[model samples]
Target: MLLVSLILLGAIGTRLAVLQLWQGHIYRDKAENNRIRIVPKPPVRGNIFDRKGRVLASTRLTHAAYLWPIVVKQPDWPKNLKYLSQLLSIPEESIQSRIEQAGYNSPTLIRIARSLNPAQITALEEFKTELNGLEVDIETVRDYPNKAMGAHVLGYTGELNAEELKKRQAEGYRLGDIVGKMGVEKAYEQQLRGEWGGIQLEVDGAGKVMKVLGQKVGQPGKDVTLTLDLDAQRAAEAALGDRKGAIVAINPQTGGVLAMVSNPSFDPNVFSSQITPKIWKQVQSKGNPFVNRALRGFPPASTFKLVTATAGMESGKYPPNTILNTFAYLNVGGTAFGEWNRAGFGPMGYVRALAWSSNTFHGQIGRGVGGPTLIKWARLYGFGKATGIELDEEAPGLIADDAWKRKNYNWEWTDGDTVNMSIGQGFTQASPLQVAVMFAVPANGGYRVKPHFFDNNQDTNKWRTSLHLKPTTIKTLREGLRAVVAEGTGKALNVPNLPPVGGKSGTAEAPPGESHTWFGGFAPFDNPTIVVVAFGEHTGGGGGSTAGPMVKQVMEAYFKNNKR
Candidate 1:
């Protein structure tokens, strides 16, 4: 019995020796490696609001399934991933593929799925022992309450690419960080990016949090208020349904952009998710749906006659009463430029030329003012420059001169080009926004206002630049534009019970024998509040027939709602 007891004692001693001497250091090191880890917290982005405090873009709290890259490199990664896949009901291969695409050794957390169900979150927490390093994190994602509404203006956010990461690493941007890709979101990124916060957590060997060490409060981004009218924006978007076109409505007094829409816009929410290749291809396949067509330049057509008229009247070359015989066509440098009407109006004065949209009279007036004078006036009217709006991707419309023609096309500036310029054709280009501003000159009593999208305290005089029009010339021009809606091609816009609106109609021949229709005008004629410019691509009709009604509809809605 004594010998039996001795044998049991030795067995116990041998087990103790193996543990204390051999495996002791390994166990000690493992315990030491289980450290208080500093986990990065993402900042909440700011909300975006329209002029009336309607939320256009906001953020929502959501749960995202993530795979930590450092933990993903463990030897038992396959087993761990399999357990995670089962717990979350996600494919194991897909999780691995996501990790690989996100950089297998990257320090950043890879998002596997977004907006997890409550049950999925519970399973993740309950199965924490089996799913090592797989975390369900709380995150703030962009939410557009109105879906695709104002998408072009509000823009979208997405994960930063390698190039963007490299460029923005110094700005505290990391991999998997979402940044604005276009539109106002891109333009106001600095304002919208908030300060990130983090927490130090005491974790176990399996990466389970045992205690919260400390945390730093993160700051949310600043709210951005835009000069957009939601109701008017809805009206404009509804008017452009399914057609590839754009409409820009602005307050002529403040130059605030009321509504700017490019049809075929995508929902910004789709970009906030894990965008698949299929969805990306769909977004790209539809007419470059990302581009803001309102800010892009297109031919102005007969609407450009206003610029020629301005140059003619301003240069003292063609007065209001100056008569030009309108034959069927005007021959300049062997180019027969025909009037829009096959049967000529016979004789047209300057005002009647604009009222009837007589291409022949304007073509002669364009020549009388010459190419240089016309180009100078066009630039003076804010063409060939950005409209100074607080938005990205704004294009400076082109106004060609002798040097410009020689530099770009190696062609000389000719009388034919002048004639085309007079009729709002040829090499001259302007955006719908620019067109709205151009007409705002006569509408707002010849005062050139700087267009903007943000409200601030600045003197109105500081923002206002004078167009230097003689009061008499301004009066005559205003009278002629009013005549357009009363008795001319713009008669399509005349409403029965509403105040009279005055504007011009334009139709420019585009590629493949199609026409781009345009209408630029102001409401009420006397006390104009808004100037709307509508452009329709390949509409196969004149502006009076195509875009005039749209402008009329938008104006009617505005007046009906505002009642001022």
Candidate 2:
């Protein structure tokens, strides 16, 4: 009896010692976890400002309700959801969806409702002890004070999805992190989204904060300053009001985007918070309201005439004053292509053909330049590609040659194709931004300025290229463009008392749709300071009537406001 008692006592003592010394930490940790809660401290989103320090985007603070799944059971949701619905007035289904989105096993707390009002916050606080898995905390949401003024430029933000979270998990982005979805917000996302931190909290069994353990406030994101001029943007949009069009105003010397306006813009504030299904549907209603038309492709119309004229003089095939014969239309392969006027400008020089926008005359020039050279010159002017701006949606406008045609359509290039391309028709297309860049060549003395939304303190040689164009060619092109506004096709832009304007007006036939009108102009023609390109999609009217006036308004605004 004594030996047996000794063995029993020894075994019991050994077991107790093992538990206390070796395996005690595991159970202690479990107990500690049950009593502790971690509250997240979200970093404030950065502000966005225009060149003049006008606020374009910022962050506003609000309260949000969170759910900690650790203490909440699966069966408890229906009753708790009902209680929450009654108190907070949020739909039970939405709360369920948020819970499901975060999953029951989410390591971090799940935010079920955001932008909570004071009433909702108070109700949640008053019933905190009875509510399970419910937590209230401070949240930050994006705010656009200007609303849709620069929506395309200053894109909105949204929570990170499953895929985005997974991809950025290694980068330390949490599942509920806010990320930029478009425009400058997207372009500089890394620089704009700052580091995140958390608050280590100790709470009672009811998920109420009992004591503060530790806290590390998150770092706010860096503020971004854009090159946009708010005054210029407002003027441009006002001028383009309600039209299915876009307008771009740029610095001729630096290629800085003074203003970029796309009509039918969506208010980014609608996306600043939780987007309702009805709001999403409404946003998608119009023809892609978010698409920046300034970056989208359209027929260059007569704006492409500058390319043809450049090809004409650069090839040394057609000199500055060399007269080219033109008539109502040029007939080839038993087909006659008609000009804007049935009676053409007859025989004329480069300056006259450009001023009159003589289709037949440009056709003769196109035939002389051939397809390959015209494509080369256009490519040199930065057509058929993106301008490498801060945005990603810029369309590389199409400029196909014989090889492209053969590959895509199994056909060879023809003189008719060249004629159409010369006048910025057929397969040739250019964005309003591209047109602005194209016109910048002569405005800044034979340099192709790379268009940019951010300030361009960049090296001059890097952002712009010297075309090395002949002096005579530059002289002829500038003279011809000036003549366009002085007395010819774009005469509508020659408003009295305004700075001298030089521009080209293009009207391209769209066949199934109305013709697209384009006006690419530079102000103070002698020593140009700004380039403004205005486009009217399927507007039916000519460039001078349809688009030139838009350019005039923007130019007036820029000059008048800037006092330049």
Candidate 3:
């Protein structure tokens, strides 16, 4: 009996030694965790503004539901999820995804649901103990007061998924972090998303908060001021009205984007909250409303004549006064490419040729200049590449030369192809923004300006390369474009009280569908300030009748607020 007693006493002493000396730190950590709690607080997202100081995007605080992974044991997880699913009307699957997104052993509170209703909030509060780990807190969400206006540019935000979290984890991004999905919001994400903070608390053994400790209250993101003009944007949208197209207005001298609009734009506010399955499917519907046509590539049609005209004059072959026989049609290989007029106006010079948008005249010039020179000039004018705007989606329109043809279609370049190229047909394409940048060259004294939204320290004005065209080339192209607005196809811009304008209009034939139309020009031609371009996709109408009035509307609206 004495030996047995001695053995039991030694066993007890050994257990105490192990707990006190070896496993002491682990138990101390567990005790500290029982007393300490941290509720992460997201910094208020930055506000977005236009140059006029009007708020374009801001944040609003709302009740949000958070789940503490530490408090919710694996055994209690299913029932707690059931409670949350019934109370918040969130699907069980969605709750599970959110949990997985934050990680099963995440030390921080995971945001499961937001934009909670009053009834749901009351239920969460009443059943707090029954639903382990769930808590109600304040959360900031993105808000767009203008709704769908400028939606493509403002973009939207959403919670981060597991993959997004993994990539952003190094940057301190956690699950449930709201992030910009597209547009300006996405282009400058780092500048727009500031630092995050946390709420410290003193808690009891049951994880109930006993005392408020303190907060780090992290810094908010810097405000982003864009070159977008509210007045011009409204006007452009009003002008576009339900049409499937895009319109762009720019300050020609500075390359500042004044206004941009894309039709069939979705309401970005929908993304600020939980997007229902119906809304998600609708967003993915036909026409893909999310496509920002302003930055998207389309057949430039007659608008591309500006490039053709430049290519023609720069080649030293077709001078300003050079005349081309503009008879009804020009025979190419086996095909007879007919002109717009059944009986073409004969013996036209460069000025009148551009004013008339003479396809045959340009085609002859294309034949004279050859393909390489035209492609070179086109590339120099910013075609075949992105315009370098603050967008991830800008399409560098196709500028197919002989080599491109060999690789893509395995076909040889032909004179007919050159003729088609001269007329802005075949593989050539440009976005409305690119077209604006093109016209800005002649508008701003031969400077190839980089179009932009944010001033980024006003470097955009200096972000230019000289075109260095001959004095005669610039003069002839400018005069021809002037004659277009003054007496040719772009006469629609000749409204009362408006300054002198210069532009060109054209239509590109799209066989199974109707033609795409385009109008690109500058207002106050003598000292151009604004370069506007309007593109009507599959409109079938002539550029003069379709896109011309849209440009007129933007110009008139801009001039209204910005009096010269």
TM-score of each: 0.88, 0.93, 0.96
Determine the C-alpha RMSD for candidate 1 after optimal superposition of all C-alphas.
Answer: 5.7
- Clashing residue pairs in all predictions, respectively, total 0, 1, 0
Q: Rate the local accuracy (lDDT) of all candidates.
A: 0.83, 0.85, 0.86
Q: Give the range of the ten consecutive residues with the poorest summed lDDT in model 3.
A: 455-464
- The RMSD (Cα, Å) of candidate 3 is 1.7
lDDT of 3 by residue, 1-564 (tens): 999999999999999999988999977776676567788888788999998999999999889988877666788888888878877777999899888766676557888888888998898898876765778998889999999899988888887777888898998887678888899999888988888899888887677779988888888999999999999999999989988889999988889999899987888888877666787888777468889999988777766777778888887787777877797888888767678887898998988988888888888888788888878888898988998888888889888999989998999888888888888888888888988999998898888889889966666548788999988888988999999988899999987878999888989898898998889889899999999999888888899889999999999988889998
By TM-score, the best candidate is 3
Score candidate 1 by TM-score against the native. 0.88
**Candidate 2 RMSD to the real structure:** 2.8
**In angstroms, how far off is 94's CA in candidate 2?**
6.4
Candidate 1 vs candidate 2, TM-score winner: 2
Q: How accurate is candidate 3 locally (lDDT)?
A: 0.86
Q: What does candidate 1's lDDT look like per residue over 5-50, in tens digits? A: 9999999998888888889896665444445555667788888898
User: Where is model 2 more than 4 Å wrong at Cα?
Assistant: 1-26, 81-107, 118-123
Worst 10 residues of 2 by lDDT: 99-108
Decoy 2 TM-score against native: 0.93
Q: Tens digit of lDDT per residue, candidate 2, span 200-228?
A: 77887766678889888789998988888
